[model samples]
Target chain A: MTEPILSLRQVNKSFGPAHVLKDVDFNAYPGEVMALVGDNGAGKSTLTKCIGGIHPIDSGSYEFDGRPVRVHEPRDASALGIEIVYQDLALCDNLDIVQNMFLGREERSGMVLDRASMEERALQTLAGLSVRTVTSVRQRVASLSGGQRQTVAIARAVLWNSKVVILDEPTAALGVAQTKQVLDLVRRLADAGLAVILISHNMNDVLSVADRISALYLGRMAAEVRRADIDHTRIVELITTGRSGDLGLAPEQTGETGDPDATPAAGGSDPAGEADAIRPGDAIGPVVEPAGPAETPTATDTDDEVPA
Target chain B: MTSVTPEAPQLDGPAEKPAVGGPRRSPADELKGHLQAYTARVRGGDMGSLPAALGLVVLCAVFGTLRPAFLTAGNFANLFTQGAVITTIAMGLIFVLLLGEIDLSAGFASGVAGAVLAVTLTKHGWPLPVALAATIVTGVVIGLVLGTLVARVGIPSFVVTLGGFLAFQGVVLIIIGQGGNIPITNETVLAIQNNNLSPALGWVLFALVAAGYAATRVLVARSRRRKGLDTEPLVVSAVKVAGVVAITAAAVAVLNEERSRNVMVVSLKGVPIVVPVIVVLLALGTFVLGYTRYGLHIYAVGGNAEAARRAGIKVARIRTSVFVICSTMAAVAGIFAASRANSVDPNAGGSNTLLYAVGAAVIGGTSLFGGRGRIVDAVVGGAVVAVIDNGMGLLGYSSGVKFVVTGLVLVVAAGVDALSRRRAAASGA
Candidate 1:
C-alpha cells in the first residue's frame, strides 16, 4: 500500500495497574475507511483518546505524513489536520446553526462581524455536504434533530482542510434513514481522498461501510481483515470468541462459503431492500435451521484473515 | 412479512405535537409561547431594540414628571453636565464587565484623580490642559498596575480591585493633604461645567445624535433581516426613531427653561462640551462591545471561561485589559466631576459613587452575570440615577432620604432583573 496518511505504532497505555492499550499497530492510508471493532472493554476509547490528544500515549510513536510526530493536545491534533467529530458534538444550543458553526472563528469585515458573508458560507458548507432537512441555516441548533446535529459536526470537521477524520459511532443513535445519510457522507469523505477512521460495534454497519476491519481484544491487537477476505462467520467468531478456530460445537462445512440465503431477487440495496444484493462473494453465516444444529469452523479458516 | 430493522424511528411526529402550548394556559397558548420566546430573545442578548425602547420611555417619564423645570432647554443642557462624568466612567466599566471582571477601585481612583487635577491646577498654579493630561496619564498608570496584578498574578479581581479601592482612597487623602476641599477657580476648568455652545450649534448637535442613532438602529435591523434573522416590525422601528427625536426636542426645551426671568435667566445656555465627550465615549463603548473581535472574545470569556480557553482565547489578557479600561475611564470621570464641582475633596468619590454607578448599570439593564448587558445599560442607568438625585435635591429632600431612595431603587431594579431572568429560564426561552 502507498504510505499511510497516519499510523499508530506499538502504542502502549496504562492507568495505574490497568493496561488500556497494548502494542497497537494501526494505520490509515488516504481514501480508505479503516474500521476498528471491539467489545466494550477492548480499549477502543483509550486508543481514540490517544489519537485525539485527550490522552497522551504512555509510550510509542505516532507517524503522520511519513514523519514521527507528537500530538499532546486537541489543538496540536487539529494543527496536524486531524479532526475528531465527538459524539456529544460540543455545539451551543442557544445559537443558530451558522453561528454555532463559527462560534469563535467568525468572519469579519473591517470592524463588524461581516455576518452576511459568514451566513452565506455556512449555507454553502451545509449544502456541500448534501444536508437538506433543515429549512434555514439561521434556525437554532436546539430545534434540530439528532441526525442534523451529527451532520453539522461532521461538516465542521471536513470544512477546515482536515486530512484525517475520526468519527466515533457516527450513527449510534440515528434513525435508519439518517444512518443511511451518514454512511453516504463517510463514503464521500473517503472518496474525496481524506482518510476516515470509523469506530463502531454494529457488525452490519462495519460490514457495509469499512474497507478493512481491525479488531482489538482486551487491549491487544487481535487481527486485521481486509474486506475481500471477510466472511460473517469469521467476523462473528473474531468478535464473540476472539478466535476463528471452531469450538467443535457443530459440523465443519468450511471451504467455500457463499451468501445464498439473500439473493438479489430479494429487494436489493439499490432503492429496494435487497438482502440478496450484498456483494456476490460475501459469505453468509453457516445456516442453523431450527431443525439443524450448531457448527464450528476448522483450524485453517482462522489463519485465512491475514492479508497477503 | 419482511421484518424491518428498527432503524426507521417514528420520524415524522416528533415535530407535530410540540406546537408550543402553555403548561399553564392563559387561553392563548400559541401566542403566549411566541411572546415568551420574544422576551427570551431579548434577555439572551440576541436583540437590542427592547432596551432602546424601554430606555427612551424611562428618560421621557422621569424628566417630564420630576421637574416641570426639567423640560426647558437650559435644564436639558444641565442634564448633560450631570450625565457626562458617569457616562465616561460607565463606558469604561462596561469593558471590564465584558471580560467578566470587576473594578471596585474606580470610584476611589477617580476621586483621587479629580482631587490631584483640581489641586494641581488651582493651588499649585498649573495650566488646565497640562494638568488634565498629567491627571489622565496617572489614571492610565494606575490602570496598568491594577491590570497587571489581576492579569499576571492570578489574583481574583474582587480582591485586587478592593485593594485598589483602599489604596487609592489613601492617595486621595495625601493629595488633599490636610485640606477638606481645594477650590478650582481656574476659568477654563470652571467653564467646562458652566458654559454652553451656541443655541444653533447645540440644537444641531442634538439633531445629529438623534439622526445617527436612528440611522444606525435601522441599518442594523435591516442587516439582521438580510441574514434571515428575526427582526422587529418596521412600525416598531419607526416609533423608536420618533421617540428619540421627541426626547431630544424635549431636552432642548428643558435646557431652555427659565426658572428666573427676574435675575440672570436660569436657562441652560448651550450643549456642555462634556456632553459630546460622554456621547462619543458611550458610542465607542457600544461599538467595541458589540462589533469588534475583542468584543466577541469578551462575551465568549464571560459566557463560559473553559469554552473560551479551549477556543484558544487569551483570557488573562482580556481580563486585565478590562480592569485597566474601567479604572482609566473612572479617572476620566474624576477629571470631569472635579472640574464641575470646581474643587475635589479626599472624600469626593466616596460613599455612593461606586454604588450609584453599579446601580445605574443594573437599572439600565446590564446583567450582573457577565454574558448579558449593553453599553447603553450604563447610559440609561446613569440617567435614571442622576434624575433621582437631581430631582430629589431640587424637591428639598434631605441627604438621608436620598440615600434611602437610592438604596431602594438599586434593590428594586436588581430584584426585577432577577425575576425576569428566572421567569425566562422557567419558560424554556
Candidate 2:
C-alpha cells in the first residue's frame, strides 16, 4: 500500500482535566476513504479538530506527506492543503453561492472584486462536481435547499486543490436522495487522488463508501481494519464493548471477557421497523452498559489486539 | 391482457403546466412565474423597500391635502435640508446595525464634534480645514475607545454606547462653555444650509447625476450579458433608467418654481448644498456596502459570527472597523447639523438628534436585527421623519401632536417589519 498522505501517532488532547483523546493513532492514504466512526462523545470531534488545526494536541507526532509537521492554527492546516467541511457547513446565509464559495479568498482585480471571473470559476467547479440541483449560482444561501448547500460546501473544499478533506456528518440531516448524492460525491473525491476522512453516525454510509473503518471508544482507538474483514455485528461490538472476540482490545486489558452481551440479542429479533422503533435514547442504555467494562483498556492490550 | 401505458397528454392549455411536462415556457408563463416568486418573497418577509415607498406616498398625499403649499418645491427643499443631518447620522448607524450592534452615542458624539469645531474656530483662531479635521479626529478617537471596550474587552455594545451617550453629552456641554451658544460665521460652513445654486446649474448637475446612474446600470447589464452571465432584460433596465430620469426631472422642475416675487424675486430656487453633500455620502456608503470585500465581511459577520470566524475572517477587526465608521460619519453629520442650525450649543447632537436618526434608519426599512438593510433605507427614512416634523410645524400643531404622530408612524413601521417577518416564517413552514 502507498504510504499515508496524513498520519497521526500517539495524539493526545485534553480540555483541562478531561482527556478527550488519548494515545490515538489515525492515518489516511491517497485515493482512499477512511471512515472515522464512534458513538456520541467518543472524541470524534476532538480528533478531527486536532487534524484541522483548530485544536493543538497536547502531545502528538503528526506526519504530512511522510514528514513531521506542526499545525498550531487553522491557517497552518489550510497551508498544508487540509480542509474540513464542518457539520453546520459554516456558510454565510445572506451571501449567494458564488460569494460564499469565494468568501475569505475573494478573487479581486486591484481593489474591486472580479465578479466575472469568480462567477465563471464557481460555475465550472459546480459543473465538475455534477451539481445540477441549483438553477443559478447567484441564489442566496438562505434560499437553497439542504442538499444544494451541502453540494456547494463539498465543491468549495475540493476547489482549493486540497490533499486531505474531512467531512463531519455529511449526511446527518439529509434525505435519502441527498445521502446517496453525497456518498457518490465522496467516492468521486477519493477517485480524484485525494485522501478523504468521513466522520459519520450512519452505518450504511460508512459501509458503502469507506475503504477502511476506524472506531474510537472511550478516548481510545478500539479497532482499525479493512472493510472486507469486518461485518456490521463486529463493528457494533467494537463500538459498544471496545472489542469483538479477537479483533479489538484483548480481555486481559479490559479485565473482562467482553461476553456479557455480545450475542446480539436485538439483532435477529423483530422486523426492521420494530428495531427502528427503538428510540436513540433508549438504545443507548443497553449498548452503553456493556461498554462500562471496557472503559479502562490497558495500553499493552491495545498493542496486542490488532487484527491478525 | 395487453394493457398499455396511456399515451402522453397532448401539449395544450398552459404549455408550462405538467399536462405536457415540457421544458419550453411562454413569455406570459414566465412572467406569471416571476410574479409568483416575487409574491412569495414578500410573504416571506423580504419586503425590501415596499413599505417605505408606501409610507412616503401616504405622507405626501395627506400633507398635500392639508396644505396645498406642502407640495411646493420650497417646502421640499426645506425638508431635504432638514433631513440631511439625521440622514447622514442614520447612514452611519446602518453600519453598526448591519453588525447587529447599536451605537447609542452616535447622536451626542456628533454633538461633541460640532462643539469642538465651533471652539477650535472661534477661540483658537484656527483655519476652517484645521477645525474640521480636529473635530473629525475627536470623533474617531471616541469611536476607537468605544469599539475597543466592546470588541476586545467583550463588553456589550448596548452598555458601552449607552455609557458613551451620556458621557459625550456632558463633554459637548463642557466644550460649549456652560449654557453658552457659539454662533458660526464661517461662510463655507454656513453655506451648506443657506446657499443654493442657479436654476440652470441645478438642472446641469441633476442631468449629470441622472445620466451617470443610467449609464452605470446599462453598462453593468451589458457586461454581464456579454460574459454569458445572468442579467436583467434590456427592457427592464431601460424602465429603471426612465424612472431615475423622471424623478430627477420632477425634482428639478419643482425646485425651480417661483416661490415669491414680491419680497424677493427668488424664482428658480435650487436645492441646498446639504442635499448634494448627503447624496455624495450616500453614494460612497452604497459603494462600500455593496461593492467591496470589507462590506461583504461585515454582512457575513453580522449574519453568523461563528461561521465567519471559522471561515478565517477577522471578526473582531470587522466589528471594530464598523464602530469607527459609524463614529466618523456621526462627526460629519454633526457638522451638517451645526450648519443647519447656524450655531453650536449644548443642544446640538442631543438625545433628540439621536432619536431622529434611529427613527429614520428604522423607518427606511433597515432591519433592527442586522444583516438585512441598505444605505437607501436611511435616505427614505430620513425623508419620512423630516416630512413628519415639517408637516406638523406647517399645520401649527403643538409639540405634543408632533410627538404622538411621529411615535405612531414609528410604531406602524416597526409593526410592518415584525409582522412581515412572522408571516414569512409561517408561509415558509
Candidate 3:
C-alpha cells in the first residue's frame, strides 16, 4: 500500500567476471522490515553494497523517494539519508559510544570538538532507540558486549536522520537474548517510519520480524513474498531450488539447462511438479556441491535443478 | 502477556527519563561510583599511567635514600634540562607510535635539523629567526618525504624510517665536515637550555598554569551541568585541580631556591627556560589530541583505519600529518640539544638518543600497539628516564653499568606494555 522509499530495478553487478548480482530487483517501503535472505554467495552482500553505494552497479535504475539517482560512493548514499551498518559494525574500539557515534562527523565549535553537545546528542539518540543495556555514554566500545556494540552501530546509523537503514548480519554473533533485543530494535526502527533492510541467515529471525521476505538464489531474486503468504518450507524451497510451488522463477529458469541469460518465466504452471521437488534432503544435497569448478555459475545452477 | 508492539508507550516513557547511567546520585555515592568504575577499569587491564606513576615514585624513593645529593635543589633543576631534549623528541615520537608506526630516524632526523641550524647561523650568517625557520623547514621537508613514502607509496613506516635513520646520519656527517663540531656563538640560541627564568617569573608562570587548568575544568563542568548531562562530582574536579597545583607549586618552589653552592657568585635560582617550552609543547599536543577533530580522526585511524575510512575520515592524510607533527617536534628538540651543548656535533642526535626517546614514551604508558597514548605520558616517562640517568651518574656508576641498567629498565617497561596489552585483550577491553 505504501510506495517504497528505496527501489532498485533490474540491478546488475559484476566483480570482474563473476556476475555477483544479476537483474536483481529490490524494494523497501517506509515503516516496513524487508528481510533479504539468501544462502552463501547468493549476492545478499553485493546487493546491499550496491544499495549502500559501496559498489557501483553495472546497470540499474536506483530510485530513492521516487527520484532516479546515481550513487557513486558511500557519501552520496549517506547524503540521501541512507546508512549501512556493516557486518563487523565498523566502530573504533578505542572510542567511547559518543565518540564512535560521531567519529568523522564530529560537532565542532571553531576548531575544537563540541564534546558536551556530542555527548548530549548521542545520549538522545540512544535513548530514542530505547537502548538500556549500555551503562554510560563514555564507556569505550571495547568494553561493550557484542550486542551492545550492535546497538551502538544501529544508533549511529539512525543519528543522521537516515531514511533507509540496512543492517548486515546484525545478530550473527549475538546470543539468544541479544538476538531478541536486536530483533525488537529492528521492529522499532521500522515502526518509527524508517525503511529497515535486514540481511540475515537465520530463518526464525526473518519469520519473527520481517513484514516482507525477499530470497536471492545464485545472484537472482527467486521471489519477493509477503510474510503472511509464505510458510517456512516454501521459503526454504525458494532459497535452495529457486522455486517454490507456483511462485518464484518458472521451472526452466531454475538453470537446469545451464543458460545464464534465461529470462524468469513469471509463474510456474505445474503446482504438482513443484510440490514433488520440495523434499529438503533431495533439494539441499545437489545444491551444496557442483561438478565443475571452472563453470561455477552454470554448474551450481544445473545442480540446483537436479531434484526438480 | 501483553502484545508489545513497536508503538508501545513503555519505550518512549523510559526514554524520557535520563538514560546515561541514570540521574546523578549524592556526592558520596557519586564518589563511590567513580572509584568503583576506576577500579573496575584497572582490573579490566586498562592500566593507563598507573605503572609509570608507581615506577616514578619507587625510583625516586630508592635514589633519594641511597644518594642524598639526588634530592638536592641543583640536581632537581638538572633533571628538567637533562630530560628536556629526550622528552621533546619523545613527545614527537608519541605521535608516530600512536599509529603503531616507528620512526627510527627521529634521532638522526634531529641531528640533521641541528646541523641545519648550525650551518645557517654560523656558516651562512643568517639571522636567528631565519636560521630557526630554516631548521624547522628542513624537518618539515624530511617529514613530507618520509610520510609520502610510507602513506602513499605503501612502504612500512619501520622500513622507510630505518632508511632515513641511516641517510640522515650521513647528511649530518656531511653538514658538519672537517671539524667534528660547529660551536654556536649566538647568545639567544645558546640560552634556550642554559638560561633560567627569574624567580618571580617562575612563580608567575606556575600561577598562570594552575589558574588556567582550574578555569578550564570548572567551565567544562559548568557547561555540562547547564546541559543537564551527567557531570563529574565537584569534589573530583577540585581534587584534580589541587593535584596539578601542588605538583607545579612544589616544582617552582624548588627551582626558585638558590642552588649555586656559593651564593656570592652566579645565582642559578630560577626555572630553566626549556621548562616553559616543554610545558607549552605539552599543552599544545594535549589540546590537539584531546579536543580537536583532527586529533579524534588520528585516534580513529589508529584504532581502526578501515572504520575511519568508512566514517569518511582521510586516513592517509591523518597518517601523513602525524609524521609532520612528529618531525617538527624533533626539530625543536634538536634545537634544544644544540642549545644545551652550545654546539652541533656529529653525535648530537646519535648514540642512545632515539632509544631514550622511544623508551621515555613507552615508559610513560603509551602503548606501542597504538590508539592509546597522551602527550603527558611522554613528560612523565621522560622524568623517569632522566632520574635514572642522573641518579646513577650521581652515585658514581660507570657508563657501562648505567647503560646495562637503563637497557634492562627499558626491557621491563616494554614487558609491562606487552603484558598489559595481553590483559586488555583477555578482558576484552
Candidate 4:
C-alpha cells in the first residue's frame, strides 16, 4: 500500500564482459522485510553493493524517499541513510562493541573522542534493540559469539538512523539458535519502521520473515511477489528456474538472456517451460531438499560458462 | 503479521531496560566481576602484557639472586638510562607494528638521523634547537620516502624498509666519514643522558603526575556517572590510582637516594631526565592510541583493512602516517643514543639497535600480528631487554652468550604471541 522507501529500476552492472546484473528492479518498503533470494553468482551481492555505493551501477535509477539520488561511494549511501552489513560483518575484532558500532563516524568533543556520550548512545541503542546477551558494551568483539557479533553489526547499521539496512547472508555461519536470534532481530528492524533487505539462501528463513520476496535468477529480476501469494515450492521454483507457473519471466526471455546468440533454440523449443510446469506439481513434496544441491551445480556451471 | 503484535510486548519489555550498566553492584562484587572477566579474557587468548609482566618479574628475581648489585639503587638508576634509547625507539616501533608492518631500516634510520644531528651540532656549529630540528626533520623525510614507497607505490613495507636498511647504513658511513666519530661538547646535549633531575624537582614531578592521574580517573568517573552510564567502582578507581602513586613514589624515592660512589666527589641522586622524557612520550602516545579518533582509525585499519576502507577510513594514509610517526620517534631515539655515547659514530643505531627495539615491543606484549599493542608495552618490554643486557654484563657473560640468551627470550615472546592467537581462535574470542 505504501511506496518503497528505497527502489531500483532497470539496474545493470558489468564486470568486464560478464554482465553481472542485467535490467534488475528491486524495492524495499519501510516496516517490511524484503528477502532477496538467489543461487550463487545470481548478482545478489552486486545489487546490494550498488545500493550501498560500493559499486557504481552501469545503468540504473536509484530512488530514495521519492527522489532520484546518486551514490558515488559508501559515504554517499550512508549520507542518504543506507547502511549495509556484508556477509563478513565488516567488524574490527579487536575493538569493543561501542568502538565498532561507531568505527568511522565517532563522536568527538573537539579533538578528543567523547567516550561518555558514545558509551551512553551505544548502551541506549543496544537496549532499544533488546540486545541482552552481551554482558558489557566494552566486551571486545573477539570474545563475542557469532550471534552477538551479528547483533553488533546490525545495531551498528541501525545506530545512524539508517532508513534502509541491507544484510548479506547474515545467518550463513550462525548456529541454529544464533540464526533464530538474528532472524528475530531482522524482523525487529523492520518492525521499527526501517526497510530491511535480507539476502538469504534458506527457503525457511525467507518464508518466515519476508513480507515481499524478490528473486534474482542469473542476473535478471525473476519475480517480486508477496509472501501471502506465494508458497515455499513456488519461491524455490522461481529461484532455481527463474519461473513458477505465470509468476516470473517468459520462457524466451529467461534462458541465456545475457548472451542471446549462445542459445537460439532455448527460446523456440521452450524445453525449460515444459520442464517447469511438469516438475512443480510432482516435486512439491520434496522441493527444497532435492532442489538446492541438485540445481546449484548445474546453475553455477552455466553461470561460469557465460562469463568466460 | 499476526505474530508481530505478540513480539511487540516482548521487545518493549526488555527494550525499556538498559542491557549494560544494570543495577550497581557493591564494590566487592564489582571487584570480583572484574577479576573473573580478566581471567576469562586470559583464558580466551587475549593475554595482553601478562606474559611480559611475568617475564620481567622472573628475570628481575633471577638476576637479583645471582648478582646483589642488580638490586642496588645505583644500578636501578643505571637501568633507566640504559633502557631509555631502546624503549624510546621501541615506542615508535609500536605504531608501525600496530599496522602489522615491519620497518627493518629503523636502526639505520636512527643512525642517519644521529649523523645529521652530529654534523649540524659539531661541524656546522648549529644551535641545539636547530640541530634537534634538523635531526627530527631528517627522520620525517626518511619516513615520508619509505611510506610513499610502501603505501602509494604499493611496495611491501618489509622490502622497502630492507632496502632502506642497507642504503641508510651506507649513508651513515658517508656522513661519519668511514671510521670517524664526532664528539658532542654541547652541555645541554650531553646532559640529556648524564644529568639527573634535582631531588626536590623529582618529588614535585611525582606529586604532579600522581595528582594528574588521580584527577583524570575521578573526572572520567564523575562524567560517566553524570551521563547515567556505567562507571568503574570507586574502590577499583582508588586501587588503580594507589597503584600508580605507589610505583611512582617508590621510583622517585629510590632514585632520590645517594647513589654516587663518593658524595663529596659528585652527587648523582635524582630521577634521570630521560625518565621524564620517556614518561611524557608514553603519556602522549597512549592518549593518541587509546582516546583519539586517529588512533581508533589506526586500530581499525590494522584489524581489517577492507572493513576500515568500507568504513570510510583512508587505509593508505594511515599506513603512511604510522611510518612517519615511527621514523620521527626513531630520530628522537637517535638523539638519545648520541647523547648517551657523547658522540656519534657510523655504528650509532646500527647492529642490534633495531633488534633490541623490536624485541622490546614484542616482549612488552605488542603482537607481531598487529592491532593489539599499547605504548606501555614498549617501556615494560624495554626494561626486560635492558635488565638482560645489564645483568649479563654484571655477571661477566660474553657478548656471544648474552646475544644468544636475548635471542631465545625474543623467540619465547613471539611464541607466546602466536600461541595466544591460536588460543583466541580456538576459544572463539
Candidate 5:
C-alpha cells in the first residue's frame, strides 16, 4: 500500500473512567477518500475529535507526511494543513459568506478590513469549486439553505489550501440534489490530490465514494480493507460482531457475538455470497416500502453509481 | 445545478422569484430589488431601523403640535446637552450589548469616575488634563477588573457587573465623604456645558460635517463599484447626501436664530460645544464598529462564540476588550455629566442614567441578544429618550408619568426585537 499522507497509530483517548477511543489506528492516503464507518458509540466522533485537536488524545502517535508530529490544538492542526469541516458547520448565521469565509483570519489593509481583495478571493474560491447554488457571496448565512451552507463550509475549508480535510457527515441533513452536489464536491477534492476522511453512517454513500474503507467496533479498529475487496454484508458483520470470517478481529476477544437471529440471516455461512443471499428481497423488504419519488434521489442517483 | 429549484424543500423557500438574495440585479431594478428584499425581510420579522426612526418622527410631530416651545432651537439645544451624557454611556453600552453581555454597574461606574475627577480637581488641586486622565484611567481599571472576572474567571457578566454596581456606588459615596456635592470650578471643564461656537462658525462646521458624510458615502460606493460589487444607484446616493445636508442645514438655522427677549436681546446662538464632541464620538464609534477587522471579530464572537473560537479568534481577549471599551465610555459619560451639571453631586451618575442608556440602545433597534446592533442605535435611542423627557416637562407631566411612558416605549421596542428574532429563526430553521 502507498504511504498515507496522515496516520494515527494506537491512538488512545479517555474521559476519566470512560475509554472513548481504544488503541485506534487510522490513516488516509493522498488523492484517496477514506471512509470511517461505525455504529453509535463506536468512537468515530471521538477519533475524529482527536484528529481535529478538539480533544487531546490520552496517548497516541499522530504522524503527518510519514513523520511523527504533535497537534495540541486546532490551530496546530490548521498550521499543519489539516482542516476539519465539523458536522455543525461552525458558521456565524449573521455574517455574510465573505465574512464567514474569513471569520477569524480576516484580511486587512492597515487596520481596516480589505473588503475588495477578500471579496475577490472568496469569489474565485467559490468559482473554482463550481458552487452555483449560492447565487451571491454577499448573502448572510442565515438566509442560506442547508445544502448551500454545506457548500460554503466545504469551500471555506478548501480555500486555505489544506493537505488533509476531514468532513464529518457532509450529507447528513441534505436533500437528494444537495447531497449530490456535496458528493461531487467531495470527489473534486480527492481528485485535486487532498486526503479526505469522511465520517458517515450512510452505507450507500461510503460504498459509492470511498477508495478505502475502515470499520471500527467498540472503540477498536476492526478492519481496514481496500474498497474492491469488501462487500456490504462483511462490513455489517464486522461492525456487529467485530469479525468477518478471518479478516477482522476475533469475535471471541469481544466476548459477545452479534444478534444471533441477525447474524445467520444477514451474514451467510459462505463469505462470498453473503451480500447476494441477504439482498434481492429479505434485506430491503421493510426499508424500501413506499419508495417512489421520495427515495429517487438517494437511491437511483447514487446507488447505481458505485465506486469503480 | 441539476435541480431547477435549489432551495431546501423542508425550509421556507423564497416566496418571490430568483431576484431576492439572488445574483446581481440590473442597474435599473437594483433599487426596486433592494426595496423588495427589505420588505420581505420586514415581513419575515427583521425590521432594521424602521421602528426607531418612525418613533422619532411621531414624537417630534406630536410634541411640536402640543407645545410651541418644544420645537424651538433653545429647547433642542437644551435637549442635546441633557442627552449628551446618556448618549455617551449608551454608545459604550453598544459594545457590551453586541457581545450579548451586560454591565449594570456602568451608570455608577461613571459616577465613580465623576467623583474621582471632582475630588482630584477640587481637593487635590490637580490640572484639568491630569484630573480627566485620572478619571478615565480609573474607569479603565474598573473595566479591567470586571472584564477579567467575567472572561478569565468565567463569572457571569450579570453577576460581575451587579457586584461592580454596588461596589462602585460605595466608592462614589466614599469619595464624596460627609458632604454630598463637590462643585467643579475649572474653566475648561465648565466650558463643555457653557460654551458654544459663533453662529457663522456653526454654519461652517455644519458644512464641513455634511461634506465629510457625503464624501465617505461616495467613496465607499465608488470603491464597491470598482470591485465589481453591487452598489446603490448614483441618484440614491445623491438623495442620501442631500438628506444629510438638509437636516444639518435646518439644525444650524434653528440654533443660529436669536433667542433674545423683549427687555434684553441676548443671542444664545451656535451649536453647543457638546454637540460637536458627540458627533465626533459617533463617527469614531461608527468607524470602529463598521470598518475594522476587530469589529468583525466582535460580531463573530457575539453571533456564536464557540464558532469564533473554532475559527482561531481570541474570544476571551475580544470579550475583555469590549468590557474595557464600555467602561472607558462610561467614564467619558461621567465627565460629560459633571460638565453638564457643572458640579459632581452624589446623584450625578446614579438614578436613571444607566436605564436611559440601556433603553436608548434597545429602543434604537439594537438587539438585546447580541450579534445584531449598531452604535447608531445608541444615538437614535438616546435622542428618543431625551425627547420624551423634554416633551413631558414642557407638557407639565410629572416624573411618574415620564417613567411609565419610557417603560412602555422600551417594552414596545423589545417586542419588536423579539418578534423579528422569532421570525428569522422560524424561517431559517
Candidate 6:
C-alpha cells in the first residue's frame, strides 16, 4: 500500500474503561474500495469515528498521505480531505437539495445567498459524479427516495474534494433497484480517485464492490483479506467462523491446497485471486462455527450469492 | 464506472450543460417535463391563515348586517386602528414562536415601555422622540436580560419569561406610581393612529402596495423561469397577485362606503392610513423570515434544535434575538395603542392585553407548538378579533359577552393548532 491515503495504526478507544476499540489498525489506499466488515458491537463504527475525527483514540495515531495527523473534530477530518456520510444522512428535510448539500458552508457572494451559483455548482457536482436518478435538485429531501438521498449525501462528500470518503451502510434501507444505484455510485466514487471506506454487514455488497475486505471480530481485526483472494462463500465463512478451514478459499483450490504459495494463480481476474496468496495449511487454527446440522447458511438467503 | 446505467434520466440537469443543441438530449427534454419541484413552503397544509382570512371577511359582514352601523366608515376605521397594535405585537411573537418558545413578559413589557415614554415625554417634558427611544431601549434591555437567561443560562423560556412577566408588571406599577392617567400631549406621535393619512394619500399609498405586490410576484416568477428552475405555475403566481390587488381595491372601496344618517352625512372614511403601516410591518416581517438565511436557521431550530445546532447554526443567538424581537414588538404595540387612545392609563396593558396578543397569533393559525405559522396569520387573525370586538360593541353586546366570545375563539383556535400539528406529525413533516 504505497503511501496509503489514510492509515490508522494501533488505535485504541474506551469509554471510562468499557473497552470499545482495542489496538485497531486500518489503512485505506486511494482508488480502492475497502469494506470494514464486523458483527454487531465489533467496534467498526468506533474505529471509523476515530478516523473520521469524531472520537480521539486512547492510543496510537493516524497518518494521512505519509504524515502523522491529528483529527480532533469532523471539521478537522474535512479539512484533511476526509468525509463520512453517517447512517442518519444528517439532512434538513425542510431544505431543498442545493441547501441540504451545502448546509454548513453556504456559498454567498456578499450579504445574499448566491442561489444561481450554488445551484449551478451543485448540479455540476452531481453530474460529474454521474448521478442521474434525481430529477429536480429543488425537491426537498423528504420527497426523495432512499437511494436518491444516499446519492445526495455521497455526492456532497465527494463534492468537497474529499480524498477519503467513508460511507456507513449507504444501501441499508434501499430496495433492489435502489441498492443497485447506490452500489454503482460507490464504484464511481473510487474510480474518481477517492479512497472509499464502506461499512456494511451485507456480504453481497462486500463481494461485489470491495477491492479489499477487513473483518472485525470481538473488538479486534480478525483479518484483512484482499477481495481477489476470496469469494463470497469464503468471506462469509471467515466472517462467521473467523477462518475457512472446512471451506477452502474456493472449490477449485479445495483439494490438496496445503501450500497456497505453491499455487500459481487463483483465477487472476476474480476478487479471490489475492486471497490465494494466503499461506495455507500452516494452522487450521481453532475456528468457530464448525460445519453442523441445523445450520444451513445457504438455504434461506435472498440476497445474491449470500447463503442462509 | 462499473454498473451505472446511462439510461437513467438526469433529474436536475442544466439546459446549457454538456453543450446544448447537439443530440436532442433526454436530460434536456426531461428538464421540460414539469413537476411540482418547488414551493416556497412558508406553511404546509393547514398551518397558515386562509381560513382566518375568510373568517375575517365573514365576521365583518355578519357584524355589519346585525348592527348596520358596525360597517360604517368610522367603525371600520376604529377596527383597523385597534387591530394594528395587536398585529404589531403578534409580528414579534411570530419570531419567538419560530424559535419554539413563548414570551409571557410581552404584555407587561409593553405596558412598562408605554408608561416610561409617557412619564419622560409628557410628564417631565423630555423631547418626544428621544423619550420614545429611551423607552424602547429600556424594553430592549429587559428583553436582553430575559433572553440571556433563556439562551445562555439554559433556563427554560417558560420560567424565564414568566418571571419577566411578573417582574415587568411590578416595574410598570413602579413607573406609573400614583399617576392615575398619563396624558400623551404629544401631537405628532398621536397622528400614527388618531389621524388618517388623508383619503388621497391613503388611496395612493394602498395602490403602491398593490403595485409592489404585483411587481414582486412577476420578478420572482421571471427569475425562476430564467434560471430554468422549477417553481409554481405562472398562473398560480398571477392568481396570487390578482388576489392581493383585488383585496386592496375592495378594502379601499369599503372604506369609501358612505352612510346617510338623520343627524349627519356619513361616507366611508377612505382607508385609515394605519392600514398601510400595518401592511408594511407585516411585509418586513415576512421578508425577514423568507429571504434571509436567518429565517432558514429559525425554521431549522424549530424543526429539530439539536439537528440545527449540530449543523453549526448559532442557535443560542438566534433564540435570544427572537425573544428580543418579540418584546420590542410588544413595546411598539404598546406605544401604538397609547397613541390610538390619545391617553395612557396606569393599568392600560393589563392581563387582557397579553391574552389578546396570544389569541391573535394563535387564531391567525400560528402553531402554539411552534416551528410553524406566518406573521400574516396575525394580521388576518387580528383583523378578525378587532372586527368582532367593534361589531359586537356596536350591536350593544356588553363587555361580558365580548369576554365570552374572545375566550371561545382562543379555545377553538388553540384546538385547531393542536389538531393541525397532530396531522402534520402523523404525515411525517
lDDT scores of the candidates, listed in order: 0.68, 0.78, 0.84, 0.84, 0.80, 0.72
On TM-score, the candidate that comes out on top is 3
**Best-matching candidate per DockQ:** 4
Order the candidates by TM-score, highest first. Answer: 3, 4, 5, 2, 6, 1
Q: Which runs in model 2 stand beyond 4 Å of their true positions?
A: A253-308, B1-37, B260-268, B423-429
Residue pairs clashing in model 3 are: none
Higher-scoring candidate on lDDT, 5 or 6: 5
Q: What is the TM-score of chain A alone in each candidate?
A: 0.76, 0.82, 0.85, 0.84, 0.81, 0.79
Query: Using lDDT as the measure, what is the rank order of every candidate, best first?
Result: 4, 3, 5, 2, 6, 1
Better of 3 and 4 by DockQ: 4
Across B129-242, the per-residue lDDT of candidate 6 in tens digits comes to 798898789768877888899999999999998888888877778877756778888987687787656567767887788888888777766765576555555555667788
lDDT of 5 by residue, B172-258 (tens): 888897568998899888888777878888888888999899998988878877877766777778887898799879887887776
lDDT (0-100) at residue B93 of candidate 5?
91
- Per residue, candidate 3 scores C-alpha lDDT tens digits across A77-177 of 99999999998899988788999999889999999899999999998887787787777999988877777788899999999999999999988887777
DockQ of each: 0.11, 0.19, 0.30, 0.32, 0.23, 0.12
- Output the lDDT of residue A206, model 4: 90
lDDT of 4 at B401: 91
Evaluated on CA atoms against the true complex, candidate 6 attains a DockQ of 0.12
Superior candidate under lDDT, 1 versus 2:
2
Over 4 Å off, model 5: A1-3, A14-19, A57-61, A252-308, B1-25, B262-265
Per-prediction TM-score to the true structure, in the order listed: 0.73, 0.87, 0.92, 0.91, 0.87, 0.80
Q: How well is candidate 2 docked (DockQ)?
A: 0.19
Clashes of 3: 0
Query: How do the candidates rank by DockQ, highest first?
Result: 4, 3, 5, 2, 6, 1
Candidate 4 Cα errors over 4 Å, as ranges: A256-259, A262-308, B1-18
Off by over 4 Å in 1: A1-4, A12-21, A28-46, A49-61, A65-76, A85-99, A132-155, A167-308, B1-75, B123-129, B210-246, B253-267, B394-396, B419-429
Stretch of 10 with least lDDT, candidate 4 chain B: B1-10
